[model samples]
Target: MSSEHFDVVVVGAGLSGIGAGYHLQTLCPDRSYVILEGRAQLGGTWDLFRYPGIRSDSDMYTLGYSFKPWTQAKAIADGPAILDYVTQTARENGIDRHIRYRQHVKSAAWSTDEARWTVQAEGPDGPVSYTCSFLFMCSGYYNYAAGHTPEFAGAADFGGRIVHPQHWPSDLDYAGKRVVVIGSGATAVTLVPELAKSAAHVTMLQRSPTYVVSRPSEDRFANWLRAKLPAKAAYGITRWKNVLFSMFFFNLARRKPEKVKERLLAMVRVHLGPDYDVGTHFTPRYNPWDQRLCLVPDADLFDALKSGAAEVVTDRIAHFTPGGILLEGGRELAADVVVTATGLELQLLSDVAFEVDGVPVDLASTYNYKGMMYSGVPNLAHSFGYTNASWTLKADLTCFYVCRLLNTLQKRGLRQTTPRIGAEALKPQPFLDFTSGYVTRAMEKFPKQGHRWPWKLYQNYAQDLVTLKYGSVDIEMEFSNPVPTHAQKRATADA
Candidate 1:
């Protein structure tokens, strides 16, 4: 029944939470905060998912934080490397001490009377409470403990071991074995080539296709800088350069779909051949950047397909059999193992319900303030990464904005902050406005963005550098509620 409190309580000790803690400490050195990590370790996505061939889908140069330089030899970093980088950032910045590992936040409810969030959590020891003025959720959408495994007609009937890449079993070996990877997203694509390296045969099963483009492991200038310049400085420069490049390409593909289509098709034509039906197998019927583009590491995947080590089956998986999976088209793909690389399942707002004055807030009916902030939700800001450019680009911006809001709170004697965007800012969120399953799933719950190119999570560092990073926090923020007293009983006590 004991309880403690902090100025801020951040859920998820991943890159986003770390960044938030770091910025908060920097902006308000006097303030104290605690980071609650569900796992025993720090890094969220980076530390989790130990599947084979785990690597950054995006280039590391931009994926890394803005303040902390990515001093890695490879621009496209693997999971372990990314995990190490985040751990090092935590340690070097002295943020590790603020993190409480294995503290699984089950739910968080806000108290309008006290102006504090009652975070209820369950750990190895059982239920606990931690109250804070500000609650920042940096947990990435996908549920780590469980990934999506669409109920196949007979998944239990599968005699052979089946695994989802999001939760790959380490003891399960696939060397010299036939493996079938289901789904066509990044997970399936990466698993196809990676398993083929060891497995006797690997087949990528998908209902539809994505425009997969091969990229060099290292760009020429990026390589030159790594060899010639100081590590941190070179990393910063390369990070910005890659960020700009990514923004350019993403905008190019979105604005001029035909150009990207031609470029993408040409690559596929050279590899798959004219008779292979690039329109069906290679081309995405939707425009480029419609969904998050899948990155192919240095044509490794293409080379694997070409080497005859792997094959792609463009048909929906019907069900699971004892031995393998059967496609809806009556094509039964037999294998020793089946890896469900299907899409991720997203949970918004940390599955926490919000209420103002005891009235439950239906997020589906509510509007998103900024890409991160929600309306009337005081002392709360969610982390949103970039679909284009790097994930950290938007993460860093959100962190910066949080810090700015904090400074404003102190200056103006404000107790709570929430975006007051009314009917004027009902535009779609940039990059996200596009039709992506992840975005579409949470559109109603998330904030409304402007139609303008950069304001919509458009990945424009130059624009965000001005708006979010440096924009003034000159708005109406409520400073109600007196500080809690000893006689004050715990309100909704439990993370």
Candidate 2:
């Protein structure tokens, strides 16, 4: 098949991809681009997961793109609502036309001689190829095909329906049934309150505790700002407000973990009441910010607990009985349905194979540059968001920087830009410092970060804003023009 050529190729049509497309069009208007989406539809994460009570853990102000305003009433929105927002953005901006759905990129090979990337993808028809001057990977960090579901001793013995949040069955009925959700992370927390509404009873079973915080469902301040000011201005002000608040809390958590732990537990205690055993369920052994804090809007989980519709069981599972899970102490909890909201399976670069000049790129050996690009990768950028703040906050900055880099390349007549590690004896650290199960499981599969500037992945959005937006690009980056091809040289000589 003939290869379709473009100036840029963006993988994934989700939040980051749409944002990247917008910036590329606005900042580098002369360049042509295409968005390759693996799924038939848009909204990557929001469209994939169909579990009950699926919503954003972070607020919408910062989660929404910098150029767009999230005017919805609820800051923490549901899956359908978030998906609609993303779809509307693409439609309204005319970005939907550039999207090629069901195009799953299998591999990308970079040619230094041509200063281009030849990407191979499997589309609905068959094998397809595309060449582009720059590649942008916006595919998220998690695997869409499956979630992290550990094998229980007798999972097959249970007659009840077992479901993983990643691949939730659309027709599976859980209404008026006793549902047991395993795990205590965001998914588990989200499903418990939602399932409790109609289920006869919902129980969250966790081996250990996670720090959970209660936040308001609606942002009164943001609403007020939208009411008084222009849409763009209101969005800007609310975005900054959220950024500052998130940064302050994250800094406080790291600086004074004990104090932050106390404050978080106190909030939980207030929501659950003094009679509730907050220590056993809400208190975590590790310090605050070691893992992400689960956000429960309006204390919905606590409200369910108070209403006797849900309960928390903290204990190790011995095995699965015919009717329910058997705890270590031989106590059996009745369960008509089991929801494994264990965690996500992290897959970087969409697990797409990469090669540079016939040499395979070993992602593990390289270091991350500015948390977006790899040390040895040229003319490529990946969208990885802040673990602490809303994803779009970092995504916006990364896309903006990529646009700037593309414009610089065009103006300078350069064909390639790659980050080369310096001679400094820098200590290498894991890319992400979180202790979450999903992150820990996939830590070795990703690249490491240096202890110093430029190579380090700072989780701080404020620091990233100054560095990515205003920082010098030539600090560790190398730019060059590829040697002219034979045809080009012959044409020049003939002219």
Candidate 3:
């Protein structure tokens, strides 16, 4: 296969990837880049997940790109709207023209001698190859092919249709039929209320509970600001306002877990009434923010629960019976359809194999540098978002920093930049502090973090903004393999 070379090769044409393209073009205009997308279209997560009630758990203000203003009225937008926003950003900025679809990246091998990466991918016709001075991995952190679904005992006995939210069948009609959604996370919460609209009765079954919060779909402050100020100015102010509030709330939750928990449960009690079992169904065993708190726009989930359209059942599953699921407490949830809103199957760097100078690199053994680049990895960075806040916040900061790093390298005439944890005896910590099943199950396979700055992941947007956008780039990073100019090469040859 022919190998085309570019200054940068961005993996995945998702929110992060498109943002990366925009930053590269604006900040480093001289650099050439291409976005390799595995799917036929863009909008990675938004396009792939077609499940009912698919909406963003985070508000749009902070979730939106820093460069773009989210003019939509809804702060908690549905999937299609978010997809439109992402694709629109690409099209308006001409980023979509650089995208190559149906390119599934398989492996990337970096050669120190060449000071570049050789990327191998499978295309529609055959294998394709590309060489890039920098490889930006915005492919996200989950497996695209499948979501995590535990092997249910006697699953074969279930005569009804059982579907995972990741792969929802479009033609399957659940109208007026009993639907059982398994799990209490964001997906289950979202699906329960939406499915309850037409389903006979929808039940959300969970072994434990998750912290859920309610907020209005529209932001009154944002609307008022937009009516007074310019769109960009209003958006910027609103974005910062939300960011500060998120930081304050997160800090408060961490410091005063009991107080936060009490308030959260109190809110739920108001929605469900005092007669409901708040302790068993609405309360989580862990502290708030321990796992991500689910967001229900306009209290839709609560309204469904209060109206008897949907119900939450907390119990372990015994097995899948012929008609529905059998609980451990001898409770059987009879249903015509079973939807597994089970957690995602997390993967590292889009499951792409990597090697440095022909030596295989295991990411699990490396240390994460600034939550973007891994230890000992050269000319490559991954866009990983925050677990506690909006993903695009961190992703935007990462893109900005990558552009800065690339520009710095160009000015210095350097070809390779690798983070080395040399002589630093630092203890390893879990990649993420989340206790969610999806994170815990796959944490061991990902890179670890250190105890110090640059190695430690703060997960704070403000701190990341200051560090990534303005901090020193020479810390723990080894810049080598200088590219000699023609004058230097001629002088050396004469000598």
Per-candidate total of colliding backbone pairs: 7, 0, 0
lDDT of 1 by residue, 342-395 (tens): 767667766676665467766555445456776567778788776666778788
Number of clashing residue pairs, candidate 2:
0
lDDT of 2 at 211: 95
After superposition, the stretches of candidate 2 with alpha carbons farther than 4 Å from their true spots are 485-495
What C-alpha lDDT values do all the predictions have?
0.77, 0.93, 0.94
lDDT of 3 at 308: 95
Q: Which has the higher lDDT value, candidate number 1 or candidate number 3? A: 3
Q: How does candidate 1 score on lDDT?
A: 0.77
The full ranking of all candidates by lDDT, starting with the best, is 3, 2, 1
lDDT of predicted model 3: 0.94
- The RMSD of every model to the true structure, in order and in angstroms, is 3.7, 1.4, 2.5
Q: Kindly report which residue stretches of model 3 are placed more than 4 angstroms away from their true locations once superposed.
A: 482-495
Which window of 10 residues has the lowest lDDT sum in candidate 3?
480-489
Off by over 4 Å in 1: 271-277, 423-431, 438-459, 475-495
